[model samples]
Target: MSGFPLPPNATIGIVGGGQLGRMSAMAAARLGYRCHVLTPEADSPAGQVSAAVTLGGFTDPATLRRFAEAVDVISFEFENVSAEGLDLLASIRPVRPAPSVLRISQDRIDEKTFLNAAGVATAPWRSVETMAELEAAVAVLGLPSVLKTTRLGYDGKGQAMLRSAEDLAPAFERLQPKPLILEGFVDFAQEISVVIARGADGSMAAFDTVENRHANHILDLTLAPARIPGAADEMAQAIARRVAEALDLVGLLAVEMFLDAQGRVLANEIAPRPHNSGHWTIDACPASQFEMHVRAVAGLPLPPATRHADAVMKNLIGPEGMALWPAAVAEPGLIPHLYGKTEALPGRKMGHVTRLFPRGALPGDLGVEAALGPLLSPLLSPLGVIA
Candidate 1:
């Protein structure tokens, strides 16, 4: 965007058309800006709400060119787009966070190397190109490690665990696209994340560190102001700021981290867009994560990421969650948001509901379950085990 505080009518182009882009477009509408979406699906979650849609593959130069010409600025909802495709978009329009940032995040090897080089802590890892190397790396990282594809892995996909030597060959053979990364599993006390945004002028704002609980390897609940020690909260925020500055990031970034039993925070993954964990900010904060993302990409002054209330965001996944839509809507104090998807496929994220509490009044596990009522599942554990 050439102009500072991008004028109200400017159209912000988003590369992927998932729920992240959908919410981001909704937020941009509040600021008087229109959103243009690019995706292969004709009736995508984002295209449903956006002003315009350019349906095509992200890598096709012709489609990329067409999508680029339709908007003034470009950003992405996910990291699956090829780096070459983003480079093409950058030549036509300003791509916030830059293609270089995407390259670092697109590959696990690059992400881990960058994090360690940035003076941020992370789990020990080694690159594997062949079975021989996998065995040697496993010997060092030890049993009970994880093997993951270097690209296109999310929601517990593209990764496998090696509990015994018998598990190694089968996993290595099953995982696709040669070149994998083996990570030493962390015996952590809890899983947490921090979402932050940085403007073109170097100003930054970060949300409170929140604990994330998962069910079947998918995010099920996020507790705002993670019920951890005060020191751990400060540490998580510090790690996120360091990463934003290191990347010279010009958009939103979410740092997924693990708080080990030793009370240390280790970077697990980085997503350069709005994250699922930050959804609570929609009801808890003066400025939601989506608003901060649009503001940063539009060159607006960054505001303090402050929250007015505590909240718990629960993801509504698959058929079971969709089954509760009516009750969720009727439940008092339950804030519901459903994606415009016709089918609630298994493991598909259909929508989310949020429950808010008075500032600093977030309750413990039993209370959270009780409040969630119909939506609550006992899979949540306050002292989460990361193994």
Candidate 2:
């Protein structure tokens, strides 16, 4: 805040070294800035591209001190970073989507509470600290609910569905030492998400809403410029704007919402950093979410979030997704991005493929309905082409 503006070439310190960091580093390089990656993995995806790599535990003060000293500003790829780690780094440089916001986003129970206090509607949920609390939660929320740990869970891990009275014990049995939250089942018609970038100057810009389809609790495909009435689309963006303003959030934030059986939007969760749902921006938008995050953290003014083309982003999960890699790479209008990960295990995000289209193409006009008619046809027919 002291300096009026940080110039390009100022180094950015990025926490976590997954694909998000990798993409963010690439974006930083494009803007004439360098990235310093801090993670324990020597061969981390982000580390490979960053100007500097600090290999150590997230809680290691010495490593964090060295990392903070090396960069002009800091940001993170994930929400689960240690609060202390961020506090240490923030003392040295500005950390966008600041540690205070990170704390609320990192825990499900706190996140839900914060959202509710902000007057955002969410699925009814209760905190569970003990078996008694879990039982009581189930009693109030009823059977057929989801029990999730308060922290460090992603991709359906650390979450269990309690379909009946008999399922409660098992759900609690599987949960680790962390606290938990049990959410009442929501009969959602569809899921949608909004991604936005808030600059340090308090100005905000957002991309179009996206219709998301998930498989086994993992995001599968995201259709950009979600087919909805203009009013409903505005409603979604308004919700995102409210959430961003509530957090006084900086950098990219993804707000996941559920369209209930009644077609009403309800908040599902908040992701403080860039999200998989916004992956299409890399291919479809002039300034992608990754670039926006870097620009915001570096104290640069946010760029226009414009979509040059409508796009479909599909995630490649597990072995089946890996097998389709070669074919995905061969498609003319498809952009294939593979995370530098070996051994594709079940439910792991191996990579993604984005299909770009001309602007304003309808679902049928752009071949979306044809391609997604069966949903799983891409795996069946190969190259995502209909047989």
Candidate 3:
């Protein structure tokens, strides 16, 4: 873990062979590093791109050991990797971002506690382990709050809204028999994310803050250089850097936050790998988040996080996204990236498209939605444009 650099041609093991891993593998190849992907899926996206792949269950000790033995270092694409599996791998080889980062990020209660203890502001929240505790938390936090499982929730799953006393029972019944946390909803002006990479030497680089727009609780679009005031953008980046340094992060970390009506920023959640919001970096920034992640974990010097152009990134969810492929490919300044997923299940993130504009060409007077709508109208019209 203390190695200053891993020479070229070294093997990097990636756990969880999803799109993040796929992109990370591609980035590693660009740097002359080979990738070994370990996942249970035989046709995983990362496996398709990596130099080697070990197909096995994450918790299988023998498979984990073999994977560790094949690679010079290890990193993961998702936070859900079993802690025990990571511990076993760490014993065999180094796991960047560290097991402690995953331990905190995989659980909502623990992540919030760590952030708060590090002097980061989060929504008012309290832990609830039982129906009685849920009731007590409701009484204290009040109505219109979110009741979510402390672990394994993503893309808005494992959550229920408690709007009134009548909602308490139904919400509790739906999410029962699991550890929960109730978070008071914040009336926010914007939802922004700061994607940063921290090197082993403690150096950190942050991408431009992105404003996210969600539909049905799934991230639909991201606009880089968030339309928020300059001061709020700077504050968001500062908070994200503080979180990364506090966690002693060795790879990429995405900090999602809410800019409240009073312009106060509050941390909402953290993703330990490359994030959907940072997809804009692929087309706009000199060094993408995936490349930065690969460099950080591989002990390579970090790249400058500079944006060459203004950009808008849109996720192509399900069949609706596939329908727009023809138009997307024809659009000028548009870059389309597909995950190569076999099925286009509804609400599934199948791919994304980013459109870059000349510097200063995009009008700052218009809001993010307004500025990007015309450019993406062809692809979005069929699915009902995101407002």
- Model 2: residue 258 alpha-carbon error in angstroms: 0.6
TM-scores of the candidates are 0.97, 0.93, 0.94
For residues 1-387, what per-residue lDDT tens digits would candidate 2 score against the true structure?
A: 235256767788889998999999998999988889999998888998999998987888999899888888888996677878888888988888889899998889889999999888899999888999999988899878999988888878889989988888888988986578999999887789999999878988899999888877889888888876676677789889999999999888999998776767889889988899999999999999998888777778887889999998889899988987877877666788988877789988888988887888736423664543332454443223445
TM-score of candidate 1 on Cα atoms, chains taken together: 0.97
User: Global CA lDDT of candidate 3, please?
Assistant: 0.86
Q: Write the per-residue lDDT of candidate 3 for residues 1-387, one digit (tens) a residue.
A: 224488888989999888999989998999999999998998988999999999998889999999999899999996787889879989999889899999999999999999999999999999988889988988888888999988888889999988888988788878845788999988888899999999988999999888888878999878777888888988999999999999999999999999999999999999989999998888888889999999999888887799999887888888877776776677665688988789888988888888787755544424444544543454443224444
RMSD to true structure for each model, in Å: 2.3, 2.8, 2.4
Q: What's the count of clashing pairs in each model shown?
A: 0, 0, 0
lDDT of all predictions, in order shown? 0.92, 0.84, 0.86
Candidate 3's error at 323, in angstroms?
1.2
Steric clash count of candidate 2: 0
Question: Regarding lDDT, does 2 or 3 come out ahead?
Answer: 3
Which segments of candidate 2 are over 4 A away from where they belong? 1-4, 362-366, 369-387
Sort every candidate by lDDT, greatest first: 1, 3, 2
Q: Where is model 3 poorest over a 10-residue stretch in terms of lDDT? A: 374-383
Ranking under TM-score, best-scoring first?
1, 3, 2
